[model samples]
Target: MYKKSLVFLFLVFTVCHGDIFEECEDVESESFVSSWQSCQSYVYCDGDESMLGECDEGQYFDPETSSCDDAANVKCFLDEVDEPSVEEEPEPEPTPPVMEQPTDVEIVNTAPVVKPNCPNSDDPSQVIFMANNASCADYYLCYHGHAIEMHCTNQLHFNGLTGQCDYPENVHCPLDEPSAHKCLPHITDFFPHPDKCSYFYYCIKGFLTLQQCPFYYGWDIERRSCVQLNVAKCYGNSRRA
Candidate 1:
């Protein structure tokens, strides 16, 4: 009875493990064969002798490639019997908030200024100085009929009357004037008097000198000098006294 029981146990073990090597006998050359029991296990055949082999973790024996391959690429129904449980992935941490920058600083123009051309004039030797229309601290000097752009240092404005850069308080730029009636001290240009047709104000050396035109002539604001009475238009009073 003891011998019979041992023989039965041996038969059971052979049925379970030995069945995998049944196909290996048909393979004449040294090769691998897929096991019927488990996809992870295979049969290595060498002539008439055979042995069981296992693939690496997460791999399966592939009969087509005749080698162990990734389980995802191998098609094995037996792998479903001991499938690994799916694990849940953890949620990502929340992102931090961004901080804003302050906006209290003053914004100033830093671009290079495009130099302007000198005003049209008949007298080339006048050496005229004109204030910049865009910036009070900048001016242009007309030398030999060409304009030389210049900047005033120490935050001073170009004084047309003084023919030099001076403090902003003492300089009256022509841009600040609402009308042409006010004489600009920073320029040597002549301006017509508001109340007199024959009289005009000439800016020279930072001073306004009132001068009268010759007989039968009136101060022409457009001409910037005296002209015949018929061509000159006076804002106030008769064209001729």
Candidate 2:
């Protein structure tokens, strides 16, 4: 009888001190728990096992999001140890330098110019198609006197004569010019182009590429995708007259 009581107590103690694996049993699969020891480290549970994981450098495991996030956004109280206050000495002030003569230097503008509006056609109601002079793979679709930039994928170029995207060998358009636009290093998602509402930048794993929306569509910054011109509110212009 006494031996049976000891066995029951042992089982209770083991179940009470089962550590992270016991805590993970109640959580759903593929969930995370912030580590009490360090803010950067967390425990990822896959229903079968619990594994320790660490966030990237300068990042902290966010308990709210269940993912590693920027340190500025995370409030980590686990690793909040009282830091020792250090006394600092005041530094001496520096002397001012003499002014130098200014030289005349030619300043050139390297900013990308805004795309031209759709050309005026004989009938404003009729849709017009025109080839982009700067790119062979891109063209403009004029809808109701509005310029809608479009591009051809799979190395195809826009054929002005055929009014369609065709093989480069079949088209006689000018050589494509390199784009002056560049993506920001910190931004790794789809973002709208500063100069063009129809164009957006796709950045992933440090590789950057420019993309365009379809006709009567504009890049929506909030939605991170192309939406209708009426819904996008790009430059406060509507799709219809």
Candidate 3:
């Protein structure tokens, strides 16, 4: 009788911890759960909108009107928008504002006249004459109704009907003439005598004319240094005899 009792206890313990309890048992072919637990281990649900035509769960299988919005984690069902049978509203026309005429001011008509004041004689109070040996013969006639100073140094070819020197062709200066010209502006009262004009530079010294101080190594007045002019290498260097 004791042996029978021991066999009964062993059989009961084995039955309690059976292999069938530990194994996963599928509730349906599509979903499954552990046989040992009441709650399902995994559940297969229909796809939402994003994965159209796909069989994967949480993805949209229907493409017709559904869109899977993972951000909202919901399937967006769009309604088919039928074409409207009625005409749409016409856009409003913009209105132009009425402007009022201004009062009290009379617009005066004036003619544009080009007065060829002698070249370099801009101030009305001052009297200026053409340099005795001015390279251009006719003096500077305002071309294009604007005054620009040009010189004729070489020959008749250098002097055009405009009374201005033509820029030399096929020649290049070490530094450009424009940049050099910018260094000096308004050479007022620069009255070097005809004989000295070729060889000397005149500077206006507080309304009195004075010769440019010889600058062998440095700029005068400013005490800034510069190199001696190589007359042979550079044209326009002073032919100071």
Candidate 4:
């Protein structure tokens, strides 16, 4: 029985070796032997479960697909890794022109110059002195609140003695009586006279003397003087009448 069992075991082993060689023979290359199973020595699951089959040189087997795809190929794509390109913005345009502002120094305020009341006073535009008795015809003009001196060109007669520039009222003498030719003594009229101006000049009824008188007095024609209160002479002539 020992001898018969030994012979049967040897025959079974030889048949198994022959089957493995025939099955793996279809894999032509000598390097294809690795595709065969070690224990049974047969084609591994018909190339599907082979240990080494159709494997990439540098890649390992991928169990999910049962293939040898690249390790780097599984990573994100180049397009995904790179960020999207940003658009460039356009520049703004310039604004229109504007007018310049005016300066404060350009504007000026001025007061009108005062004028004389007389129609044809030496200078019609020249201003005259102001007094309490100033009339519309002989309106008084002021300069810095003070009365200004004026020529007697507007008066018909002048009283030298009393320094009045208006006509005398109800004189005792006749109109034809020639009066003394005289001028007023007021410092504002006589002392400070113009160097070349005519102090006396002929007028309508008598002569006009460049002089001044106080508001209360009038000219005394017969005496050639100004009278205070229209009655008495306030100033005397150089020559006694």
CA lDDT, every model vs. true structure: 0.58, 0.56, 0.27, 0.31
List where candidate 4 sits over 4 angstroms from the true fold. 1-139, 157-241
- Higher-ranked by TM-score: 2 or 4: 2
Alpha-carbon shift of residue 130 in model 4 (angstroms): 3.5
Query: Which candidate has the highest lDDT of all?
Result: 1
lDDT of residue 65 for candidate 3: 20
TM-score of 3: 0.18
Encode model 3's per-residue lDDT on 1-241: one tens digit a residue: 0112222222212122222322223233322221111111112222221110112223221222222222233322321223223332555643433433557645434322223354532333332333212232223333222344333444221323222334445223222243332214444423322332222234443344434323222121111112232221122332322
Tens digit per residue, CA lDDT, model 1, 1-241: 0112222222222223343466676686667677754676676666435566666656677787666667888887664554334342555633333333546644533322232455565242245565566555667765444555677876566776666778766986553343754555566766667666878878775688889886456775433556665566554454344
* Candidate 4 lDDT (Cα, 0 to 1): 0.31
Candidate 1: residue 114 Cα off by (Å): 16
User: lDDT (0-100) at residue 42 of candidate 3?
Assistant: 17
- TM-score per model over all chains: 0.26, 0.24, 0.18, 0.14
Q: Please give me the total number of clashing residue pairs in predicted model 3.
A: 6
How many pairs of residues collide in each model? 4, 0, 6, 3
Candidate 3, residue 238: how far the Cα is off, in Å:
10
User: 1-241, model 4: which lDDT tens digit per residue?
Assistant: 0112222222322222223343344654322232211111112223433322333333322333323345444321222333233332444533323434546534323322333332333332333343222221222444333344333444323333223355534211123223422333431212211221112133323334455433333344323334433252222332111
